[model samples]
Target chain A: MTSLVIAGKTFHSRLFLGTGKFSSNQLMQQAIETSGTEMVTVAMKRVDLHTPEDNMLEYINKETIQLLPNTSGARNAREAVFAAQMMQEIFETNWLKLEIHPDPRYLLPDPVETLKATEELVKLGFVVLPYISADPVLCKLLEEVGAATVMPLGAPIGSNKGLRTKDLLEIIIEQSNIPVVVDAGIGAPSHAAEAMEIGADAVLINTAIAVAGDPNVMAQAFKMAVESGRMAYEAQLATPHREADASSPLTAFLD
Target chain B: MNLKLEILNHNNMNIIINNNSREVAEGCTLERLIDEIGYKEFKFAVAVNNQVVKKTAWDETILYDGDKVIVIKAVSGG
Candidate 1:
């Protein structure tokens, strides 16, 4: 029942999937259907003239799923803005996943470029969801610049390390007023559950599912994990303690 | 033969599309070019020299010799 609302649009599923890394488009489609994700991220690329590919858009049902186009290969703000414009025209949606990673080595987002692009894209009427490092101040700045959501990395993109920035992400989640989607480096279903339990608005996952031994089953696992984590969060987990605590009292009569 | 070749050259111009050189009829509209390049069946957005061209304007926009045309479509990514 806890739906995620961004830019006045309601998303029933908090598990956002990335449409990448599948061996085939059919597998990707199956994974999406199995995961029950309402929001998915896509990237834009120049069409190959020699070998035009089957349009992947046909597989995605627009009525059921929301397309979130990303500026993944943009190395700077200018490129990101240009890609946003192109994406707006191609996808016919203003929902953008703004990522400006200049370095190919780590693929760490350039925070300065991300902040700059977010401000510009927001002004252009695009709902910007910026992928940034787990810097709480940067998250605040992005929020101030009218970003719809802040997607702080749990680890480097495609690393599968699982919440390496937990402490920083916790601070970001605690301080942020807008939705905080933990993106990247979430390798397992448990990681997704952990993220939700920590009160993340949502989690974006791709590599973990696409490369799994069985993507369909893995997708189902993630779906259940996200729901379970969200339910646990809603139920309010009990406080943890280092010392032993008795569940039952010792009665003098028994002694 | 020489006269025919001259006429053909005058009516056509070479343009760069997605980094490949191609011969399109002179003053060809972007819409026509898209059809010629087999992109009409696909969903895409186009830009000429880094400026995005709206779908509505594709019919009116013309391409010249050596002009760079970039057509982008949605691909899978995270």
Candidate 2:
């Protein structure tokens, strides 16, 4: 499969897994290995940082997975900016996943705040990847503001709803100059495959693998599915037909 | 009361806080201050002096004079 490159780093695997809600760190590690993911996401919080011996960090570092620190807790542009700066200092990397949501219940990304954060982050010498809704207009706005990638959610985060916004995602894929990574709410391996088949550069999954009975096996499944989907996409799928055509040709007058 | 306010005014780090300023003593742990502020309803993480402080270590961690404390929400997206 063709490698996926983002912000000067080439990723062999297009499936990016999230490190959260796993039964154990061992399971999480197994899942990461199984998925063959080159990049994994981790949230930045004061509590996790305080415990310098956090097993999550240790596990991820041992595996040599590239860490993508997310501003998951920031409510507004100012807070997100602050968190981004702190994360840069802590992680020693300019890469960040800018997530700004004012509402806590649904966890939908605030478009205005997200756009604002992306602009500021890009100016601050960070490789900004803003998480947003599947709004094509918002995606264009983010791209114009210098975002390295636009991570639009497929469904509500952790809901495992598969490509509910497929139409909008298609628009994003067609319009985007930068990479379009389908970020949240992807449940199964098939969902990852579908996203790739539709030309999504990458997909980030969390709950499905973390909560699975056999996370390692599931991770491996996802790995294969993503690769297969990417290969299919690169191969160029046949145009789909809406209705069956007559085998012998219904309009035979000309013939 | 007047002398304490005067001393606070002279301090460079001291800023006028409207809510529960009296509850802040000269030296109190972050845990104690958070409890006093009644912010337990919200899921928050604390950073003291530019360093992250875990919930487990909040009680043992003491707050000194002129320290900057930032309390942020835990799950803030959407």
Candidate 3:
């Protein structure tokens, strides 16, 4: 029911989808539509640049979906900055997902480069949503640098590990001045629910839904889970106590 | 006779776009190159010599012989 307002734009869905790993572009479209996500991430690469046919954008319903281009292949600040500028120039959206991972194996975010790029991108008048490790201090620094939101990973990208960095993510979510979007390592709808229960403004998922037996059905499931989790959080579920007491009371004093 | 000879003498510049060698009209601008490549409806970015050539500069930016141009598309990624 509640909308997520990020960078002055309101999103009706708290579940943001990543457009990758689908069997086909058509399938990806079906999943995206079923998920009801307003924002989706796209990656830029040299191979796709030369081939005009089979372009991914053709499948995305741009009228309904807002494209969030990511700096996925960039390994440092300079490369990420270049990718961001290129993405804005081409995609016609200033919203950028700044991801700089020098490591090819785990695809972890480089905190130093992310900080450097965020500061630079903010100064360039771009709405920056940076993906980083679930480091609370980094989240604060990114906020100070004027990032639109902080997207911290629950685990390594595409690992399907499901919230391996739960403690760090909770700290970030608790202290973040900007929206904390839980991104990466979410294997199932339950993982999304867990992230939402902890007060994440949004959860970004890709590999989990894309690789499911039925991606469209899985998308719907995640959407429902995210909505239910957000609703539960808003309702203020009662906290559990360390010890249980009898409803009638264990004993009466000096009766 | 002179017009036919001039037309036949004209040379197209050879350049590498996204690692594919192609020939374009002499003194072609990056804007013209994009138009020639039939990417009018698609969203893409251009880089020459590993340096990004901004969209604002496309019209005035001339492509030189043997320049390495990279055209990239924003596809699905996580």
Candidate 4:
């Protein structure tokens, strides 16, 4: 399997993990270790900030695990920018996962504000990875504005709907110069495998593994699937012919 | 002549903290209030009346009567 290279950093695993919805922080940590994902996402929020030993951070903070703090609750470009700055101030990392969704119900990303925010964040010397819809044009625009990586969601956030936007994602993968990390709604290992098979730089799984009956096992499964799929893609998969030839050779083309 | 005595420390001051109405001592600095609430050495973000107060400024940033203070920390979210 080819290693994923994003912004001069090399990641051995193509499966990026999201630290959310797990039964416990211990379980989340175990699943992350099992998955072998070098990159993981953590959301910034207003909780018990004074507790130096936040359960999730205690579990995931390591030299090996790179935390990409996301602006999940931001409703606009300004709010997202503020959240990103806060993350930088608190976490001491310029890397930010920009998420701007005004609508709270479905949590759909606003393409206009996302593009605007990506440009601004990039200018602010941040390694911005904006989570956006599977719009090929928007991905190109983000690339033009200097995004470190473009994370396009496969389906809705946490719906476990698999790659419902497969066609658009395929277009995005084809056109993007930066890494295309398929970011949400990956239901199972097979779904992750399909994404890797289609040449996505990586797949970010959260709800599927976090809410699994056995997250550790599920993480392992996704790790294997991602590796396997990347290997197949690297080996050059042959395209299947639409029409199958008859065994008896009913019509000899050579004749 | 009639005069109304202002008892500052004798009466509990009503204030809004983390969106909850709470009684704290009058003239409490944010740092002292935070320490009083057992949040010393804890990593958190604070906002007073919608303005964020950094950790360095918390010492001088005092809570006033009816002032809304918001204290937030990291949580499990995606």
- When just chain B is superposed on the true chain B, each candidate scores a TM-score of 0.93, 0.64, 0.84, 0.78
Clashing pairs in 4: A47-B73, A49-B43, A49-B73, A50-B42, A50-B43
Per-prediction fnat values? Answer: 0.91, 0.01, 0.79, 0.45
- Residue-wise lDDT of candidate 2 within B1-78, one digit each (tens)? 999988875542331222112325555677886675563444455677657676778899876655767654332111
lDDT of candidate 2? 0.79
CA lDDT of each prediction against the hidden true structure: 0.93, 0.79, 0.89, 0.84
Better candidate number, 2 or 3, judged by lDDT:
3
lDDT of 2 at B1: 100
* Model 1: residues with Cα > 4 Å off, grouped in runs: A252-254
Give stretches of model 3 more than 4 Å off: A47-52, A245-255, B1-10, B54-57
- Full ranking by TM-score: 1, 3, 4, 2
Docking level of model 2: incorrect
Candidate 2 to native Cα RMSD, angstroms = 7.9
Worst 10 contiguous positions by lDDT, candidate 4 chain A: A46-55
Residue-by-residue lDDT tens digits, candidate 4, B1-78: 123334644555877877678788777788887776674444566678877777798899878889988766555566
Q: Which ten contiguous residues of candidate 2 chain A have the minimum total lDDT?
A: A46-55
lDDT of 3 by residue, A1-255 (tens): 688999888999999999999989999999999999999998887744444567788888888888899998899999989888888867888999999999999999999999999999999988999999999999999999999999999999999989889999889988987899999999989999999998999999999999999999999999999999899888877788899866686676878
Q: For all the models shown, what interface RMSD does each have? A: 1.0, 8.8, 2.0, 3.2
What are the per-residue Cα lDDT tens digits for candidate 4 across A93-162? 7888899999988899999999999999999999999999999999999999999999999999999999
Q: Pick the candidate with the highest TM-score.
A: 1
The total of clashing pairs for model 1 equals 0
